[model samples]
Target: MTHRVLAAMIKHETNGFNRTPTTLRDFRDQNFHLGEAIPRVYRGTNLEMGGFLAAAEREGWELIPAVAASATSSGPSTDEAFEALCMPLTNTIRAAGRLDGVLLGLHGSMVTASHDDAEGEILRRVRELVGSDIPVVVTLDPHSNVTPEMAARATAIVAFRTSPHTDQAETAERAAAILARTLRGEVRPRVVLARRPMLTGFDGARTHHAHGPMPDALRRARALEAEDPGVLCVSIHSGFSRSDCRAVGPSVAVTGDGEDPRFRSIAESFMDECWARRGETTERVLSVAEGIAAAREWRPGEKPVVLGDYGDAPGGGAYGDGTAILSALIEAGIPGAVVANIWDPAVAAQAVAAGAGATIRVSLGGKHDPEHGGGPVEGTARVVAVSEGSFVFKGRYGTGTRGHYGPSAALEIGGVTAIVTTKNKGIYDLEQLRIFGIEPTAQSVLAVKCMHGHRAEYEPISSRCLDVDSGGITSGDPLLFPWQRVVRPIWPLDPVEGGTP
Candidate 1:
């Protein structure tokens, strides 16, 4: 029998420490697509309709597209905005009677003004509307803080394995397929969550070789998946503790048979491994100054120096407007440099007003959190080029996806060209610059405001790259921030407990 399925995608990863509160306006600023707008804006990559369509075609199930809304990482979403986003989906589900299954794409770290567990709240509402027996599957970013509520509500859940998250579509397909199988009575879905005290240490937790203990744990989990005939997938969620929610920490989830002790044990074992490798994971990192110094003198032909601007990382709930690195480069007189996407909507508007080739005095960077990034760099820059902000993915990360910078321009300030945008998108595609008349390959130094995801794309083009410990909300150092809600004795915060307090 063909079943009817409902699907929607609404995602946002919030950093509680950010000064600016995320609102519906911020979503507009970031170029978020509501239900119908997704197809027109984002085409292929992680398209909400694509997942539902793929499942419907493959399983002969009727599909309904309700809503799809996503905003870039920021502070807790206002209560009004959260409800505004979720209402459309809940209303559709209510009207649909009963659904055979449901699929949702969630970031898993959304902190709303009224709710800390935004995903869980949505799940609870959806479960109430659809009832508990209907299979619900979810696709999440690896950075998710998987709450108990989420595990209890979602029958089958999968997380993108890579940090750059190029596999979003693949992960969504897997979740949808799993839901279809469960609905067809071909498989029963089960889940168990294992918690670790320490926050998943700074970046690279997604890296294959540098992942340290994660690779081994994943290997063992895969073995368990093979051994247990019922086990379909095992996921290690390196939780996003920057969210400052109650359910924040690393987690292990195994999905297959209902409430299997073996599955729970397998997940627990992986959590133990994560706890064991806490010492090797370094959280506090070097500053941009330190990273620049290292890169300036880096061996002529060494590994591409990846300069990860943790402070301004768009993926990590930052404003992505920090100018510390750009200012430093100017001061040091670093020649042959490229900086992708300084979020200066105001400046972008000014440039559009002035037109290309016109020299103008513009304020760039530090618009959102002036105190953190040192409040705007004022300068007269030549607007060499302008675009409506369209670029193709040429980098290793997001290779197949299309990126829109949303009214972008290249502002040349001496030897360096700063790619400015009205939208806040981290540098994951090389075309982000090339499309705006700035090619990164020819540059001696490139600065990217990203957490770890930038490595996948920039590493291929960079002669050398280094992660800068720029001081901001998403810093590598966990101890630098005062986390009150996180479980006690997690890593460098309380080393005596070995991060298990």
Candidate 2:
């Protein structure tokens, strides 16, 4: 019998400390394709949906595309936005007569205004709609906070092993393949999850294998799967620390046959390794002044120095309007320094109105909150260039998608060049600078507002990279934000006992 499977994707990583609530407009602005439209747009992209289509075609399974929606990482989603995004998928499932299995692409750290465990709640709803007999498999970001509810409801869970997440399509294909085997009665998969008492960022979770502890732990997990016949897949979720939910922190999940006696121990050992390396994962950051001083001393013939403004990472729910680093670079008189960028719509509009080659004085960035970063820097700037804020990504991650910065402008203020945008975007590619006529490879210093995600794209070209704690909502130090929801006794926040949660 030919099997029919339903597939959908609804992904968002929420920052609980962000004051602005993500709305339905945000999803619309990103990409919200429903029904047949989903495949038409996403089938060829490097996204998870592309993999689902490939597996369905290869396995001769009937694939039903439901809803595929995603928004930029931001604050908790509004109730209306959550319902709007989920209803299309749920409604589609209700209309379908029968199905052999289900596949999903989810960011495990989603939080809504009304729900803390958003991904778990989504799985529960799908489980209710499909019933228990059908096998459900999901592909999640490694930074997901693996919840018990997610483990109980879904038959299997697989996460992208790479931190910069270049293997999204591969992970999705694996999930689809596993579901196919389960439907064929070749295996009965079950998920075993374990959590560690740690709340750490991705600074040390680099999957380069030679560089960090994350790869070694993943290697051990892969070894466990190879040794046990029942073991299906092993995943280490480092967890997104920006979220202040109860399930916030690192976790390990083992998916295999229920009869496997080794699943629990294997999962525990993975979590234990993560717990042991807690100190390495903790981020050490430099002040903006210190970062600029180092950049200024770079000798000629050296590779470009990349400065990461951790606090202003829009990918971590920062407002993207922080001006501290920009101010410091300008004050230091660093020539050929390109900041790409600061999200300030007002300044972008002013630059557009002034036109290229025109000089104007404007207040740039820091319009969100002064307490997060410093207040705006008022300066006289020459409008070097302006764009409609649309370009295709040349980075390994999201390689083919067209990204928008809304109305944007390149402003030359003294010795530093700043790219100002109406829309907030975390830089993960050199094209973001190239589009504005700035050549990143030739620059002396490239100041980007991002964290680990930028490493994949910039590190190859950078002689050295520094993480600057410019003090914004997404600050490397989690203690900077007041926490009320996350579970207690998590590492660095509170002491753990006996190397366990």
Candidate 3:
């Protein structure tokens, strides 16, 4: 008998510190496709849904696409938006009558105004509708906060092992394979989770395997699966620190066939390794002044220095309007320095009105929160170029997806040129700069508003990459934000003695 499977994706990584409330328009702006529309847009792409489509074709399974929705990482999603996204998935499952299994693409750090553990709640609703007999397999980002509720509801949870998240398609394929095996009665999958009392940011999660600890942990996970026949899949989640929820921390999930005592031991061992190297995981960041000084020391013949403003990374729910680094670079008169970019719609509008080559006086960036990044910088700038803001990704992540930054302009203030845009986006590709006529390779310094996500693209062309602590909502220092939800007694917040909670 040909098996039928229901597939959908609803993902968003929330940052409680952000004041903006995510709405339905955000999902629409990013991607919101229903049923057949999903495959049409995602087919042959690097997205997780593309993998599901490929798996369906390869396995000869009847695939019923429900809805594929996601928004840029931001503040907690509005209750209405959350319900609207979930309704389509649940409604589709209820109307389908019967299914062999369910496959989902989820970001485990989702937070809505009504629920802290939104992914878990989504799984519960799906479970209530489909019942426990049907296997439910989910593919998640490695940065997810894998909750116990989520682990309990899912038959098997597969997450990307890479930090830059180049393995989205591979992770989804693994989840699809697990679901197929369960449907064929080849294996009964069960997931076991173990978490450490540690909370670290993105710096330590880099998966190059040469310098970072994450690669070693991943190797251990792979070895355990190879050693034990019962082990189906092992995922290590670095967890999103921006999410100030109770389940905010790194964890390890071991999926295996039926109940196995070894699963717990393996998971615990993985968590132990993470806890043991907790100190090495935190990133050592430089201040805006230090970053500018480093740029000043660079020579023209050497490869450009990439200065990452991690605090203002839109991927981590920051406003992307912080002006600390930009103002400092301009003040220091760093020649051939290009910042890609500052999110200021008003300034972009002014530049467009002035047209190219017209000099205009404007206050740029730091408009969202003055207290965070020293307010906006008011100065006269020469508009070098203006664009409607549209480009295609050539990077590992979102390789084929189209990106927009709204009305944008290239402004030259003193010696530094800044790309000002109406919309906020984390730097993911060289195309973001190249489209605006700013060649990153030619510049002496490329200041990017991103975290580790930019490393995949920038590192290849850069002589050196440095993370700067230009204060914003996404600051690397977790202590800067006031926390009310996450469980207490976590590392850096409190003392972790003997590497145990």
Per-residue lDDT for 99 in model 1? 78
| Ordered list by TM-score, greatest first | 3, 2, 1
TM-score for each prediction?
A: 0.91, 0.96, 0.97
> Can you write out model 2's per-residue Cα lDDT over 2-50, one digit (the tens) per residue?
8989999999989988888999999898878899987788776778998
Q: Where does candidate 2 clash, by residue pair?
A: none
Clashes of each: 12, 0, 0
Over all chains combined, what TM-score does candidate 1 have? 0.91
Cα-lDDT of candidate 1: 0.76
Q: Tens-digit lDDT track for model 1 on 197-259?
A: 666632335553544565666667668777877888887788888898888877877897766
Q: Which stretches of candidate 2 lie over 4 Å from their true place?
A: 201-204, 282-284
- Specify the highest-lDDT model's number: 3
TM-score of model number 2 = 0.96
Q: What are the per-residue Cα lDDT tens digits for candidate 3 across 1-501?
A: 889999999999899899999999888877789998988888877779989999999999999999999887899999999999999999999999879899999999999999999999999999999999899999988888999999999999999877677778878898998888898899999999999777762335777536656888887778877887789999888888788988998888899999989889988888877877777753468988888888888987989989999888888888888988888888888789998888999999999889999999988888888888658888889999999999988888767767788889999986689999988788979999987788888889999998878887888888888889889988878778998888878888888786565
